[model samples]
Target: MSNTGLMIFDGEVLRSIDISLPELQHNITGAQLLEISESKVSKSLSGLTLPPNLKNAAVSQVSDGDDVTFRRTEFNQQQASEKLGVFISAVADTLRDAPVVVSVLDGSMLKMFLEDEDDFAMLAENLFTDLDEEDKGKLCKREIRNALVHMGVDMGVPPLSEFPILDDIIKKHDADGDEELGQAQFAQLLQPVLQEIADVLHEKPVTIVQNVEIFTGSRLRKILADEKTLKCLVTKTILELSNEKDSQGRADPIKTLILSNGKELGLPPLSSENEPVALLYETIFSQLNNRDKQTAADASTEDGLMDSLKDILRKFEDLLETAPVYSATNI
Candidate 1:
């Protein structure tokens, strides 16, 4: 049996694991999870029955507060599998702006709303698809990729293998019997798991933006040997808060959206009135900047919330370096 992570969008659920025939182990067989589906377990398994000993197939869905009743199992796993990625792409887009509102106990309308949410694309898809014409992004690949990575994690591939600044080095041998990277068997082991997770996450709309570039080390040996080059990377997103208007209950709602690198030295807040949109860009523009000097790439994003959180940590460490914001009354 496999332990899996899943996300739900509307009538569809996005998955992080691939459910395949080979993976239908006895442990996860009976355990089932139901989300916003018109399909009934009885109906779907009518012809394709679960083994009598099946035990732990579970499912979950994210709520947006809509109510509905799923009486019949009308969903076909095969059909659901085909459209999973497309479904997830839609939900991802909707959630980026704001969470989709769901009403409790209104399953019928909720299903209808989910069906209508099909066209909304996810942010992960947006970032990748926008540049899709130029090239593929680490995030924008098929749900198959997502499944493979997750399965790889289960099989114990270090998550660091996916990092832009990292390399997934697979040596020719390990006494532990784990398949080495690039082996035909290793690739094959991932196929089923990949398909399942891809099917699921393709249904959910939540997008976790990880560092993008994923070309492996051997894929970059010549470039790294140094022809003296510069490149740009997103270090961390910076946000500046503002007191626009106080809500009846809440102190003050966010009035701005600022995405910064936090290195402009001294840029003033754009406003205290309305929402703001700002983005900070860090680049490797000169030959000298490419040298082994202190830079954003050397920083750690593997653990921190923001890319340059070290900077924030240092600032907070020194109390003398902080200042108070202007109060609403003062403004």
Candidate 2:
């Protein structure tokens, strides 16, 4: 699975935030955390944006209705930071634990198609012709299931896998029987079956978790803006390189580092199997090679390596800004 843009509260993301230490030194209240407005907290956060769908869930987790600890509490800078960090972490946890983003199949499309007389007539005729193999005017009632499949999910019909009610719906119409049906009988069976599906969907919309890679660069941009966080990342990368004994290659270290940490930095997962991501890396690395011949040599030092990583990340950000990627997930 690809990384989700939704923030999964981590120490790294919490540390990246730049909050006013002094502002949080006063006596705190559970109702208002550190005098920080939701908007301010949101802005201070790095590498995390709370999407609208998740706002309510996050807010609900921010409080537990117990204020005994925070009432009339005065804390030092470290304590204040810790307190605020706890709250932020809770919000992130809520978002992460909540369901992945989903699309609701509420039968609106099917209703619209049914409402249009010309469209429904054409659709029925087409389905009849397709199912009537051997050019026979009649078809087995079992073909009604095929008709439903022909309509598919695009017409607001859920897959049998996603919506098991479809089987029951088909059975209710006796469409499972082998009784022969002419064009009119087939259309008659189809219309009511579709109508019933639409009614069921109207009562309980099917939520489909789309498998997609959303690369808006918002998280990446936030990470890039946090100088302290960038410095910390560089320092950690250097230590990892030293421990792994991976200093021989020029740009290879950077490439490996990025491929490993791209998801954390809000880029799509980079692997050989994912062509779009692979091509992105190829293009960026190609440019890096052409522009800086001494990149390999520069990897010997800390500052030089940091500069190279920043450059590569900036290229990714720019590219993503121009063309964001999204895909539908099958649940």
Candidate 3:
């Protein structure tokens, strides 16, 4: 009888297999293997077919003796942007007319009525009557927890003597540091995240200007022609923004937004010196401010685009050291 033992090697080591050669005889003929050399086994077996299920399945190769390998899917920017947009819209709509107190400590845990319109109205009315004169429109830690409990929201944590988490939540959202949360303070806590989400959702194409005086005009053309000078100016603008700090000593969000928008608009790896980074900043700032003006007239709009833009501009204007100033002469 012909020697029936068939060994399979994955890079010099034999791989374990429970199936016998008789099972694969129809797909891989003994005559075929006898004709091929040991070095040619891998190439010859490439055309061999296994069971239909196994043939269609994806098989991964392991070279470093690892039993398994993971394949990660590429990040899809467009899909992520769309999902963030939907989430932002949903949150904005939920809080538009509701007495919501979003936790600043854990911003993801928003406190809003999940009931129907009529139920919410009744709950608000009942809650209002229970409120003391001093706490009429404000929610303290105890009151917030009670309200949550009434709304059937489970805290999910083991009962503690004082629920220290509530204190942290109050401290973060309490703008005046009074251990309570008001509508205005709640909105403030929510604004930054909402603004970022809006920015991602409403990403417009970068307006590339060719005939602009600042970029293509006589004086700018000379400065921009030197690649080194252009790169220096762009780097300087970013550094200026990076050095700016807010009241909390954190990097200013408006400047951060401007820089982020600039990157998305392809400002860093500038295709041409004719596309001035300064113009990109100016364009983003103008578009944001103009959008605010247009949306401000509507008081009932849920997107809060106008409010978000105003907040960003207020921070931008308050920056003691502004972006590098550029002057343009007519063509």
In candidate 1, residue 192 scores what lDDT? Answer: 33
lDDT (0 to 1) per candidate: 0.26, 0.65, 0.32
Q: Per-candidate TM vs. native?
A: 0.17, 0.48, 0.16
Q: Model 3, stretches more than 4 Å misplaced?
A: 1-112, 115-118, 133-163, 175-331
Model 2, position 150, has a per-residue lDDT of: 81
User: Which residue pairs of candidate 3 clash?
Assistant: none
Number of clashing pairs per prediction, in order: 43, 3, 0
Residue 112's lDDT within candidate 3 is 26
Per-candidate Cα RMSD to the true structure, in Å, reads: 24.2, 11.5, 26.9
Q: Pick the candidate with the highest TM-score.
A: 2
lDDT of 3 by residue, 182-250 (tens): 644443343332233223323421111111211112222233245554344345544554566653564
Error of 2 at 266 (Å): 2.0
For residue 2, model 1's alpha carbon misses the true position, in angstroms, by 30
Q: Sort all candidates by TM-score, best to worst.
A: 2, 1, 3
- By summed lDDT, the worst window of 10 consecutive residues in model 1 runs over 276-285
lDDT of 1: 0.26
Off by over 4 Å in 1: 1-182, 209-331
Candidate 2 structure quality by residue, lDDT tens digits, 1-331? 1111122232234444554555543555544553463544455443123455444443444444344555455556565556666666655565433323434567776777688988888888999999887898999998988888887655667679879989999999888998998898888888888888888988877654444546655567777888787677677777777776444542455766676677566677666776776788788988866755587768646788678888888888888777665534343
